[model samples]
Target: MKVKVKVVLKDGILDPQGKAVLHAINDLKFKGVGDVRIGKYIELTFDSLDQSLVENETKEICQKLLANPVIENFDYEIEELT
Candidate 1:
């Protein structure tokens, strides 16, 4: 099984890195950009094909280690590789 986790800043939180990237993009003449936010992407491969267990473990990992509960929120998806 393949798993993907995305961690992003909560709404109303400032994102300096995303802002900096946006400013740089604008400086290079990119247009129609409104806003940007930065976050983390995590990929995991599990040998088992049990989607429910994988999902539960992934959620636990996100809450315990992958994402900061205070400032960030996380979501995950699971896919069968083969």
Candidate 2:
């Protein structure tokens, strides 16, 4: 089983890194670009096929170590590849 986790800032949160990238993009002559936000992607692989257990464990991982729930939001997907 493979799990993919995405952690990103909430809609109302200001992202300085994203802003810097946006500025660079403008400086590079890209037009019509509005706001930019940055996020993280984490991939996990396991030998179990139990989706419920995986989801629970993944949520625990997020709450404990993966993301700061106060300012960031996270979601995950599980896939079984045999």
Candidate 3:
């Protein structure tokens, strides 16, 4: 089984990195670029094929370490590999 996690800052949170990127984009003469946001993408492979177990563990992993409940949010997708 494989799990892919994406962690991103919550709405209304200030993203300094994103802002910097946006400013650079504007300076580069890129028009119509309104905003920019950055996030994390993680991939995990599990030996077990149990969907329930994978879901539970992935949820716990994201909640505990992958995402900050205060200013960040996370979501994941599970894929079974044969």
The candidate scoring highest on TM-score is 1
User: In terms of lDDT, which candidate is strongest?
Assistant: 3
Q: What is the C-alpha RMSD of each candidate to the true structure, in Å?
A: 0.8, 1.1, 1.0
Error of 1 at 6 (Å): 0.4
Question: What is the per-residue lDDT of model 3 for residues 15-78, given as tens digits with 9 covering 90 to 100?
Answer: 9999999999999999999999999999989999999999999999999999999999999999
Q: Give the per-residue lDDT digits (tens) of candidate 2, residues 1-82.
A: 8999999998999999999999999999999899899999999897778888888899999989999989999999898897
Better of 2 and 3 by TM-score: 3
Least accurate stretch of 10 residues (summed lDDT) in model 3?
Answer: 73-82
Can you give the TM-score per candidate against the true fold? Answer: 0.94, 0.90, 0.92
RMSD of 2: 1.1
The runs of at least 3 residues in candidate 1 whose Cα sits more than 4 Å from the true structure, single-residue gaps closed, are none
The CA lDDT at 77 in model 1 is 86
Candidate models: Cα lDDT each: 0.93, 0.93, 0.95
Q: Candidate 1, residue 16: CA error in Å?
A: 0.8
